[model samples]
Target chain A: MNLPPLVQGFVLHFGEMGSRWGLNRTLGQMYALLYVSPQPLNADEITEKLGISRSNVSMGLRELQAWRLVRLEHHPGDRREYFSAPQDVWAIFRTLAEERQRREIEPTLSMLRDALLETVETDEEKHAQARMGEMQALMEQLTTWFTEMNRLSPETLTRLMAMGSRVAKLLELKDRLRTRSG
Target chain B: MNLPPLVQGFVLHFGEMGSRWGLNRTLGQMYALLYVSPQPLNADEITEKLGISRSNVSMGLRELQAWRLVRLEHHPGDRREYFSAPQDVWAIFRTLAEERQRREIEPTLSMLRDALLETVETDEEKHAQARMGEMQALMEQLTTWFTEMNRLSPETLTRLMAMGSRVAKLLELKDRLRTRSG
Candidate 1:
């Protein structure tokens, strides 16, 4: 409710980014404010800073919790709930990845598995089936990869980012091999 | 219009995934189906298969076309417009990176730049400005990184996917550093 213009702009920007991320305007702004603040924030602080209704902040907090983007906090002397994001960016990233996988990836995968069972009646159907099989396999492998990636030690992930410069040439070389020989 | 159950499931999953990727459900599904299929799809084919109105498919196709995810094809004697995804996974991925930068990142960056100009007087405003400055710098860099990443040839992009296994670890390690030191 009392955010500075700069912070307000930050909130407004995230509000816009929210729709792109399958969230709404206010949701985006609320999370942006939460994420950037150095200290943990309570609902009342959030409501006062954001100038939204108390109920809206409450609902938004619920959604953010579901996304694993926000963690609840308790102060020794205070009865009101406070929330914060993991200070470690990697932890936040992993939580987001896992949440998206659970909320989006796993269910779609199950549906694909079920669809794989439908009987085919025509050559077109069979061809479609074949193509579907390829994508389904791809999705399954991607899921497996995410599972492993999420479980990987933090040090290992850091090494991976450091290796980005090397990967460009390695992949380009592999592409040439597949193109020329295959 | 006919897709194998497995492909159907994955395509539908992608459709669902699409919203998360900044597309609506119908557009997501349409692109998913197109992405995995061997043949180009017509609007009517998409409408009939997805059980959406023809107009919706028409609009979705237009949006996909704008995103560069769909390309028009003229089959010698065929008058109807048909569309297909880029044949290579890397190409499709590149389109995604580039298109999203254009549609979402670039505009937001501009907005942030403008907001950065507003003069600050209070301590809270200064605090907000400091945070906004940090985020804006990181976002500008990220946008730059995506642009540079897209400029890499498809061969380079595929190789980068292989690098995915390493990125998680590197990012995690960075988080540790920031935690102990920052």
Candidate 2:
């Protein structure tokens, strides 16, 4: 891409990080370009700037749409589609968390659930089932927490995060007050 | 592996999920085997069970050790190294979080810092820097929060997650009380 040096650096970094992030390099670069761009871009423009084939851009965009990381836009009187990332950073973060939960965590939880239902005939099976039960419990707790947090406004979430470790102290105070009342 | 059906199911599932979790199939299976094993196992046992080559087992163990997901053990009168996963699931979760933050998040934060330092001569560069700044700020806030959470005992951390969205209401209550007092 003929992006400004500052933007290019960030795009390149994301491209490099793509594999670790479970995205291909081209897709990562594609998303980065969209994320920093001031306006929505069409496939032709994206292909020209990033210097990749039109087919690859189309494929990457499709993958990004599936991930809900990119949005499709249509300009007035134009048949060609355009793409852009969500403008709000918090929204983007929330989208990513939700997507990962759905795509990765949910499947694993389902597998664990199915595994837990099977009859155990040996000590090894018993131990394995117990471990699976623990994992399922933890995942359930996390998903519950995630669902609750998902309902929170971005402002509220930000406040919660800013509280940092101070949250533990608050929990302690609340517990002591409860004990005294009882 | 000639593992019991129950144990084998879990191991095979993890092996399939390896790519999505930033691990290879064999490493995923290797860790899964150790995690559910009744006792610490030597390399030969792992090879025999997983039916992978000895070299692959050795390489996978070293990688797991590097990730701190597997521990090395020594038995009296035996020269071969034995390995096992931590029995505590909470410990495993914490170790994974810390490793990811170190390996992935920290580097991105560093790169953002460097990019922010450069002078911008155009509108596009300025806009890009602004976006980078936003991302950097969010990352810093998250890292701070994560660091604080990392300090908590497992009991405390579990309690916090259990708190879920309830924490937001508590925050609101505290804020209202402060306003009234002021």
Candidate 3:
């Protein structure tokens, strides 16, 4: 692979981190390449730059598209499909969060709910159900919070995040005001 | 493996879901077993219940301890160490977040910082650096927010989460009040 040294370094590092992020090495490297490139890259360019097989690039692009991490574009008068990472980083982050919730968190929550519905035949079942209940409650709360936050415009979300835990001060103020009014 | 049916079902599900959470199947199953069991369990018990080899259970337990997901204890007269998941689900969630930040997020941020420090010889390098800067800024903001939240007592954290995006309304109110005061 004859990528620029900087891009090469990041691609390799991302590939290594891929498993931790629930992606395989090729997908990570492909995404990293697209992410850092100045222009949308076709599968042929990707294969040549990354020294990967055509089929592998095809597969990786497919998976990335499935995750909503990559977008397909067509160049003027060029029919070959090109892939590019989302231009906005926050949009990329939001896509990842949404996809992971749909693929992993939502299914796990559903499984817990199903388990909770089953009849308990013994003390062991009761204890297991209780554990599932705790986990389900935690998951529901987090998912609810994410769902609410996801509805906000990106600008609003950024402001809210920038506020950070300073929002706690607001909460404290609200509580004090309520106490005085009551 | 003679696990109770309900416990077994959850353990198997966790094992399947483990890779998505950056854990192997064995680690997920072992943690699941400990989480659902009413009492602390020793390695032998885990091995028998999960039908994994003794060595696999030992390795899994060692890794789980490293992740701070399991606590080790000793019985009054028994030499074998017993392991249990933290009783509070929030505590488990916190440990997982802290560990992931340390292992994955922090290192990625550091890598981005290092990349940003490099001299750019070409437009490609310059563009890549800009992208890296954007990502670094976003990550810094997120880590800062998490650090601030982590400082709050768990009780306060719970309250903030329970408040969810209602906090956004508070942000709006604060903005309105600031406009009047200014």
Candidate 2, residues A1-182: lDDT per residue as tens digits?
67777888898899998888888899989988988888899999999988899999999999999999999989999999999998888888888888878877898899999999998888878888898898899889889988988899988888988888888877877888689999
**Which one is best on DockQ?**
2
**Candidate 2 deviant stretches above 4 angstroms:** none
lDDT of each: 0.72, 0.89, 0.89
Whole-model lDDT, candidate 1?
A: 0.72
- As for candidate 3, its clashing pairs are none
Residue-wise lDDT of candidate 2 within B1-182, one digit each (tens)? Answer: 87888888889988988878888999999999999888999999999999999999999999999999999999999999999999888888889889988987898999999999999898877887888888889889889988888888988888988888889877876788689999
Native-contact fraction for each model?
0.35, 0.75, 0.67
Ranking by TM-score: 2, 3, 1
**Model 2 chain A worst lDDT window (10 residues):** A169-178
Give the candidate order by descending DockQ.
2, 3, 1
- Score every model by TM-score: 0.76, 0.97, 0.97
> Tens digits of per-residue lDDT for model 1 on B1-182?
45556566666677777777678888888888787666898988888878889999999999989989889998889899999987655465466768866877777778778777888887766666666666566566556555555566655544455555654544555567569997
